[model samples]
Every structure is written in structure tokens, then in C-alpha cells.
Target: MAPTAHSAVIAALRAVGVAPDAYGPTLNTAQSPRDVDVVGEGLAGEIRAVAAPAALVVWDTSDEAVLAHVVARNLDIGVLRAFEVEGLLRVSPDVPAGAPVALLATQWGERRLAGLRTLVANRGGQTVAVAAALTSPALAAVTDVPTAALASSDEVTGVPS
Candidate 1:
């Protein structure tokens, strides 16, 4: 049987020496209804600032809800569309140089990462991949740089929502 998402996330975190439970119960409370909206807004703002004329590729339906919320805000930055990985790969849209491309996912998996890499290679743009959990593996896979390097690099910054 396949491991559940929760288990997979926990295992991924543990593989990188992150004790999932090290934070204890204080970090395990229920999320508020507005949490997704808040996160989405921040992410949307970041994407808009850097890559206004960008495409948003979402990996899961849950993420699409965030996309919808982002769209409803009518930020007027540019055309923001959500595509499945396969569809985006097939479409292979043209991305202008220096424009930002964003991938939104609640979890990271091999297939999704591979697709994002391919899309970036084919489209040619600054890449930003955001995962709801932001595990170490996810960060490394998205950046193709050592996590330590990312920690020191001014180019990459993470704000926890």
C-alpha cells in the first residue's frame, strides 16, 4: 500500500534530520479558515512583484482553490493561469526572459519536480516553486542548489505563513 501524504511528508522531513515532532504540540494546532487565503495572498504578491506576466502551475486541486482566491483578488499583474504538470509540459508556452514562473504544490513528489525542471528548461525563466510544507528535499529539488547555499544566498528568501 502507498504511504499516506502525512506519512510521506513526515518521512521526507525525517530523512533530512528534521524531527517532525520536535516542535511538540504547540505547532500542531488546527489552522484557521483564512490561513490559505493569507498564504495565497503573500505568494501571489511575491509572484506578481517579480513575474507579473507569469503562469502559475498548480499540482493539486487544493492548490487550485488558492489560485482561485488569488485570481478573485484581481491583482491585475498579468495573466495567471493554473495548469497541471502534464498539460503545462505539453503546452510548453513561451516565457519571456527574466519573467518568473511559479509552481504551487501542497506536497512535493518526483514527478512534479521533474515536470517543473522540464518546463523551466523549455521555457527559460526565473523559477519559483512553492510547497505548502517546504521540506528540505523540496527546497533542494526546486533550487538545484545545496540547501546551505540557499540559506546564505540573498536571492532566495522564505517567509513562513
Candidate 2:
């Protein structure tokens, strides 16, 4: 059977020498706003492990509540909401040039990859790290960007491998 996203994330954490159990409880207990969806298990841990300290985490607005909880927990972490461009969510142009950027996503698609590439190019070619619940071949094809696949399927869309 294909690995579930939750399992994938745990494996990735182990591969990095971080025990998933170390942060699982902390994330599970995070207090998120009532209106926004909470980030799934393993995702926040992956972000904490993969993203550099002080890196600006760019994410979909729908994830604001949980991501905010993450940022609150880690005072050094920063966040930015992806902005709409041509009806697709793209990295915001306001990200400071040369700032380390981490894309925290629940899924990957052509539009998301395009936005990442554009952000990289616009930011003086600094590679952007990605910590996502679901990934695709297109995401893997980008050899330069570092990524952590934190889940097997798109939880929001129920798209399984």
C-alpha cells in the first residue's frame, strides 16, 4: 500500500534524526483559532525541523490559524500569506529579498510550483525549502528545492496516491 501522508511525514522526521513523537504532542495541543482549519499531524513538526530559524513561512490563508500557532510557539519563525495571482495562490511579492523562505503547503500542483520558482528567481535565486503534506512528480523534479513530504494524500481534497 502507498504510504499515508502522516506516515511519510514521520519517516521524513526520523530520516532527519528527529523523533516524530518529540513534537507531535506539542503540535496536537496547539491552540488554533476557531475559524481556520488546524494543520494536520506531522506537518508542523516537519516545518519546525526543515525550515531555518527566522525563515519566512509562506502558506495558504486557510492555514493561518494553525500556522499562527506555530509561529507563536517559535518566536523566531515568521509567516506570510500566499496572495492570489490570476486566481491562483502565489507567493507574495512583499517577501524581503534574500530572506530565507519556507513554503508550508498541504498539497503541490503546477500553480504552486510556478509560484515557488518565480519566488526563487525573484529572490536572487535562493532556494526555497518546502514542507508539505502532499507532493507530486513535478515537485520532485525540482532538484534545487529541498522538500519534506509530510503526508501521502491531500487531506483537504482527499486525493490519494
Candidate 3:
């Protein structure tokens, strides 16, 4: 089974105790280089915990290093682009189990969970990703990322990749 979106990598980062103030631009979108700095810091710690491969889904190309940091820390990473609910849904079903993923987006707060769940389930076991809201409010607001953006496995597997 694959990791779910609830326990996604970013959520796990929070679960492990990384300060929000040290992780991003705001809490919505990851636009500031400062936000990436925070994410990289927290991600460094996360990478040390897991022994398996992981992936990251980012909304911007600017986030490659953030993803690379995770990979360098020892986790695997994949990149996704978008903060919209539907965009995440389109990319979720492909996360591999034991391979947590990270989601980097702008501040959306608690307005998006349905999409997170759908994406998280793609991993099968539990969600695994480090999510960074590249904007403000500095907290997930909710326990998990949004799931509203996810689509069925059949719909996502064939995506461009």
C-alpha cells in the first residue's frame, strides 16, 4: 500500500515538531525563498527519520531544491505543480507506499482536505509528504492537507507524469 495524504510528509514534519515560523512564506503558497529555507530545515529532520523512499509534489519550479533537500536528506521526491484542489487530485493516486511525498503550496489553511485525502490514499498505507504553504498564517490549520483535488486511480495513472 502507499502512503496517504493525511500523514503526508509535510504533515509528518509538523507531527514531529518543526516550528511553523521556521517553515514558510505564509501558509498558503511557497513563494518566498525564506519559506523554502524553512521547509528545507524541517525537511532535513524528516529525512533523518524515514528509511524508505519518498516523493514531493510542488506547485512551482522554484521548489526543486526544497524537494532536493528532502532527497538529499535521504528521502525520494517527485514534483507536482499547483495549489488548486483539482490539480492535487490529478497527481495523488500515484504515490508509492512506504514512500511518503511532500506537497508545497500557498496558504489555503483549512479550506482543502477532501483533495488531500484523495491524494494521500494513492500511497495506500498512510499519507507521507512535507507540505509548505509558501504564504502566511504559518500553520496547517487542519490536521491534514486537502483531498478535494484527487481523482480516481484509473484517472491519475495515465497522467503525463
Give me the candidate number with maximum lDDT.
2
Model 2 lDDT per residue over 1-161, tens place: 12564544444333322112211111222232321122333455555565563454444443433544454355455565556567654554456667666665444565655675576556543545765555566557656766766444343234453
RMSD of each: 12.0, 9.4, 14.1
Off by over 4 Å in 1: 1-33, 42-55, 60-62, 68-88, 91-98, 128-136, 144-161
Candidate 3 similarity to native, TM-score? 0.39
lDDT order of candidates, top first? 2, 1, 3
Worst 10 residues of 1 by lDDT: 146-155
Ranking by TM-score: 2, 1, 3
| Pairs of residues at least 3 apart in sequence or in different chains that clash in candidate 2 | 5-151, 5-152
Give candidate 1's error at residue 93 in angstroms: 6.9
State, as a TM-score between 0 and 1, how close model 1 is to the true structure. 0.44
lDDT of 3 at 25: 23
| lDDT digits (tens) for residues 40-79 of candidate 1 | 4544544454434355544334334444345335445332
Q: Give model 2's TM-score versus the native structure.
A: 0.56
Better of 1 and 3 by TM-score: 1
Question: In model 3, what lDDT does residue 3 have?
Answer: 46
lDDT of 1: 0.40
Residue 58, candidate 3: alpha-carbon lDDT: 46
The reply for model 3, stretches above 4 Å from the true place, is 1-42, 46-53, 60-76, 80-88, 105-108, 122-125, 133-161
Higher-scoring candidate on lDDT, 1 or 3: 1
